[model samples]
Target: MDLLFKVYPNLNVEEVATETYLQERSILSARNDDVATLNELAINQFPGELHEYLAADKAIEDDQPIKNRGNIGCPIMLLRNLQPRDGLCNGTRLMVIQFATRVIEAKILNGSHVGNYVFIPRITLQPSVSETPFQMARRQFPVRLAFAMTINKSQGQSVKYVGIDLRNHVFSHGQLYVALSRCTSSNRISVLLGNEDDDKTTNVVYPEVLL
Candidate 1:
C-alpha cells in the first residue's frame, strides 16, 4: 500500500500546450522516447489554452512556489485502497491512506473506521498484509500518507482550489498534466512538498513527437 502526502504549491496558470497536443495526439505515441522527457519539454512549450493549463499544473507539481489558499474548495481526497488481487492474500481487505494531514486525521478520526467506528486498526490503519500480522501491523503504523498525487483522479472535477501531492517518484508526466489541467485558473491551485528531495526537479517537458 502506498500513502500519498500533501506537499505542493498552488496551480497558478493553466498549461495550455500539453493539453492541446494531447488532444491532437493520442496518449499512445508511436515513438519510443520516455514519456517523461516529452512531458517535461512539450508541456512547457506547446501553444494552446489546454497546454498552458497543463504546463502550469506540471510546474506546480514540480514544486514551483505559488500562492497558497488557506483552504481548498470541494477537495476530493483520494486513498490507494489495497486488496489482494491474486492468490494467498488475494481479496484480503487492506487500504493505504496515500495522503495524510491534520484534515485527513480529523476526517478519518485517527484511523477509526468510518462505517462502524469499530476501532479496528487493521482495517482502518493497516496497509496490505503479506506476512505475520504483527509485522504487517508494525509496517502499517509507519505507513503515513504523505505523498501528493498526479492528475489521474483530478479530471472531470470542478473545484475552486486544489492541493496536490507531488512527492512520489512514481508520478509520471501524464499524471502531472492531468492533475494540473483540472484547475480552472492559476489562483485555484496550491502544492505542498513533503520532503526536500522532492524540491529538486524542474519544469517537465514532453517530446514534440514520438521518434
Candidate 2:
C-alpha cells in the first residue's frame, strides 16, 4: 500500500481513495462474514507481529508479508483462486496490463494462463474452516504485489529463482523445505547464512506433519 501508492500510479478513485474495500466494520466476525478484511488483516497484522517477535527471539526476520501498492508493469500475485482455464489461480503470477480506479487488467505470467489478459474484479471470499474467530468474509480486490510472498502463500507455486536469507532462523515447520522447493532446481538458489550459525541449527522444522 505505502510502497504501491508511492511507487505506482495510485488507481484508487478520489471518491474512494481507500486502499482496501473493507472498512472497520468488516473485522469482527468469525464465520467469514468479512472475508476480505480478515484476509487483509491476516496478511498485515499477526504475521508481521510474529515476524518482529521472532526477530526479537533470534528467528527469521525476512518472513514478513509484503504490502505492495501495485503499479503498471509491476508483477503481482492473485490472492484468491479464480478462472483456472485462463490460467488464474491462487498463486498465479502476472504483470499489470492496465489499471482503472475500480478495475485492474493484467496479463498472466504463470501457469497455463501465461500471456492471457485478465480483468480482476472485487470478489467475496470465505475460509473453508469455521473453527476460528474472525472467520469473517468480505469483498475486495484479490491481488498482492509479487515482489515477495510469504512461505505459507508460496506453497504449490514454482518460481524461477529462490533466495533464502536466514538472518533470523526459520521459526515454523517446513518453512525451509517450502522455500527451497519453490525453485525448480538447486542451482537456482542463493542462500545467505550469517557466520555465527551452524547449518544444522538454521534449517529448522517440525518432526512429523507439516506444510
Candidate 3:
C-alpha cells in the first residue's frame, strides 16, 4: 500500500474488507467447531474475504482481479503486446512511476528498455473466459503488478533469475516445464516445495497437450 501512496500520492486504495458469509458452511455446530479447530492448525490460510467470496454462489459474476490501485514505484507487467522496440512488450517487467485516471507513466525495469520511462495508454479489453457473462468491455491500461505472475504469462520470455512456487501444483500441462525454463539455467532458478500434506506440491506434465 505504501507503493500506491508513493506513486499516486493522492489516490486512496480502499481496503477490500472481509464481509460476512450469507449462509453457513455446515448446519451442525460440531462440524463448524471442527473446521475452526483445523483452521487453527493450518498455516498460511486463505484470506477471509477470499474464503467467503469463493464460497459464494455468484463469485464469478463480478470476478475481475483488482488492478486500479497500483502504487508508484511498484513493479508492473505489461498485459498487452506493445512497443517491443521500446521494451514494453507483454510480460515485460516495468516500474510504475506515475499513475493517472487515464494514462500511466512507468519505467521499464527489464530488457533493453531498462531504466527508460514510458507512457502507457488505455486500451479496450475483454475477458476471454467463456463463463464471463455479459462480455463486458473495459477501457483501461493493460497492466498488472509484476510482484507475482503465472507461468503461462511468463512464457516466451527469459529472465536472469526465476522463482517457482509449486505448492499449488500445475493445473494445466507444461506449466512446470515453462516455469523452470524461464531462467537461463538451473543455477538461476529456485523452486519452493510444500510439506507432505500439500497434495498439489508436485511438478506435473501433460504429454497429450504437448502433442
Candidate 4:
C-alpha cells in the first residue's frame, strides 16, 4: 500500500535495524484486522526470511486458528504484562533479535528498559469466560507484529511518522483524534479514507465531554 511506503520508507533498507527507524514509525487503524493486514505488508518488505509461529488452541469442540508470522528485525508488541516492574508491561514494543523453539530474544524499544535484551517464553493464555462462547486455552508467544496497531492500542505511543488507515471509519469516540495525535508533526501523518475522492473522516465528539 502507498501508505505503508510513505510511513516506513526505510523498511526495505538497511536502516530497518536502526533503533530510531524501528521506533519512530507506525501505522494505526480502527479495526484489528486492518491493522494486522498492514503489519503483514510491512514485515513482508522487511529484509529477512519469513518465520511462522503456530498457536496451540484448545476448546471443547472449537479450535482457534491463530498464527503469527515475523522475522528477525521486526517489531513486536507484548500482549500480556509478563513483568511490569522490568518494563515488560502489556503494550510494550520490542524488536525481535533471535528466535528459538521455546523462547524468543528481543530488545525493548520503549519505556524505561529501552535497548535491553530480554527472553520471552511461550505462555498459556485463557480468554475470560464472558468473552468467549466456550472456554479456551491458547499457548503461544505473547507478542504480535507491531508495524501496525489498532488505534486503541496506539494510545500511549508517540511516533514521528504515522499512517492512519481510515478505510473503515473509526467506531469509537475520540478514536480519530487518538490516531491523528500519535504523530509528532501534522505534516508527517498520512491518512487513507477508503476512496480516492473521499476527503473527510467522521469524528465523534460529545459537547458535554468538551464542556
Backbone atom clashes (below 3 Å) for every candidate: 48, 15, 3, 0
lDDT of each: 0.28, 0.51, 0.51, 0.88
Pairs clashing within candidate 3:
3-71, 4-71, 7-72
In the range 1-211, model 2's lDDT, one tens digit per residue, is: 3222221223233323222211100111112222233234333421111111111111123232323354455456787778777777887877666676566798777666567788988665556776745344545568865544566666766755555544446667667777777777777565545568765445565656653
lDDT of 3 at 33: 36
Candidate 4 per-residue lDDT, tens place, 41-107, comes to 8888888788888888988876776787888988999999999988899999999999999998999
Please tell me which model should have the higher lDDT, number 1 or number 2. Answer: 2
Model 3: worst 10 consecutive residues (lDDT sum):
20-29
TM-scores across all candidates? 0.28, 0.55, 0.56, 0.92
lDDT of 1 by residue, 81-102 (tens): 4322221121111122122232
Model 3's alpha-carbon lDDT is: 0.51
lDDT of model 4 at position 130: 50
- Answer with 2 or 4, whichever has the higher TM-score: 4
Q: Predicted candidate 3: what Cα RMSD to the true structure?
A: 13.7
lDDT for each residue of candidate 3 in 1-211, tens digit (9 for 90 to 100): 2222221222222232111110001000112233223223221122222111011122335545433445555455787987888888987777666666567888776667677889988877766785744565566677754544666766766665555555445666666777777777677455554576344455566677667
- For all predictions, the C-alpha RMSD in Å is 17.7, 14.1, 13.7, 2.0
**Residue 86 error, candidate 1, Å:** 33
